[model samples]
Target chain A: MSTIEDVTREFEQIIPSDTAAGQSVQERIIQMLEELRFEDRDVFGIRLAMEEALVNAIKHGNQMDPTKTVRIACQIGQQRVRIEIEDQGSGFHPEDLPDPTADENLERPCGRGIMLMRAFMTSITFNPTGNCVVMTKDRSEPEPETPAGESA
Target chain B: MSQGNRRLDLEEVNGVTVARFTDKKILDESNIQIIGNQLFSLVDDDHRQKVVLDFTNVEYLSSAALGKLITMDKKVKAAGAKLRLCSIRSDIKEVFKITRLDKLFNIFDNRDKALEGF
Candidate 1:
């Protein structure tokens, strides 16, 4: 995995607080990920995580305020892909979030995005303001060898 | 929500409502609202049970979409119906497993297997 010191390429963009704009930003990031030759599975997970973060930034963080903007920064390296997303809103503590996995919370729909981000990425952290999220996926592990009887 | 702006292709088979969303990337909030309304309406308004969401074409899902699924599942359960998911790719299935939603809802490898229990 590439350490923070070994960033090969970096890009950043500020998207409007519109869902359409968010999709465009995600597509641009996906293009970069493809150029990096990330594994299919990794690309899928990264895309989902990026969407979750971007959605949270646009909806929950900016509250769909057209005047607000979502800032996204990407760092692509030989061994890792890192992204940071920030929104302009009153930040909320990530620790205060309800456990979506808990039986009592399972039925609620909105709390699972953060959990999904954590699940897909190798590392996830929220800024003190709670308005920014940084996530990374490491490519350190070798692809699992397909079993003899199974086709990949 | 309206007939003109349908985002999902819903099919009724053997009393099971199979909702197939075609967007390869379901990352936006607009998509979430559409999917949430479509899935929840199946239970709350249409009163149809045994809903199956086929993800054969969906390559990715945002967290907001995941939340909508949870809401849809709860609505189905409250209506005394079952919601099953099928054809989720292995890469995306990891999200369900990580959130422990694989335990909360019935997931099948394909639509036929998902329809079996319903």
Candidate 2:
């Protein structure tokens, strides 16, 4: 029998609604993901999801006003990782966003971020106010055992 | 790579203008604006009839950056020029695939391959 190792880590950062700050936040998240030994594809998923959320919070939610702030929190556990991003602006309904992949909408660029986040993360939800979004991705379960003297 | 202005390094190969994005993280608002303007300028220039964006050095691009690409693609087509992309990382490719922009643009594995289309 094998047991799952348990680890819990939490990080919080409050950054002004400046686009420059996004790079630092991305680096921090990448470091954390690397420490957990996540695979390149998983790291890319997390990075892309986080980038989408942070940019939305700063550019749309905060309107890139330096006076406003975006709050981001991350919790990583053995089974899963969760991230929350909240912005200080009037939130819009997520469902109202048009489908970027649609025939007529394919030329549009702004709606794709939400679609990418939905495609990468295991789950994505928004607060009632729509000002905050929570994203989660489950860790990969241990691989099934291979037969003796056989490669996986 | 020396920047022609701030965020992009431009060079002409044969008859195509290859504008390579230099930033590893292209999430900044200002950087997006600068890049978009530069690409639009290339689309408007008569000498630059063929434009290829080399994403060899770009690690990440925000939705705004993708939007700029779409806008540039449209402009390039309207101006009777060509817009091609080369050396896009898999992660970014996933974004393009999800948005179905992969079907909208001509993407090649390398600069030479992209140039061949022109």
Top-DockQ structure, candidate number: 1
lDDT of 1 by residue, B1-118 (tens): 6634776789999888889987887767766677778778888888986789999988878767787887787787778988889999887788788888899878999999988857
TM-score, each model?
Answer: 0.88, 0.86
Q: Against the true structure, whose TM-score is highest?
A: 1
- Stretches of candidate 2 off by over 4 Å are A1-7, A140-152, B1-6, B45-47
lDDT of 1 by residue, A4-55 (tens): 6578778889989987997887788788778878888888878888877887
Per-residue alpha-carbon lDDT of model 2 for B16-91, expressed as tens digits? 7888888887767777887787778776754478888999998888778899999998898888888899999888
Report how far residue B31 has shifted in candidate 1, in Å: 1.4
Candidate 2: tens digits of C-alpha lDDT, residues A1-152: 11224546788899999767876887887798789877667777888888888889998999999899999888877677788899998998999988788899988757888888898888889988889999988776555668899963
lDDT of 1 at B113: 92
Cα error, residue A146 of model 1, in Å, equals: 4.8
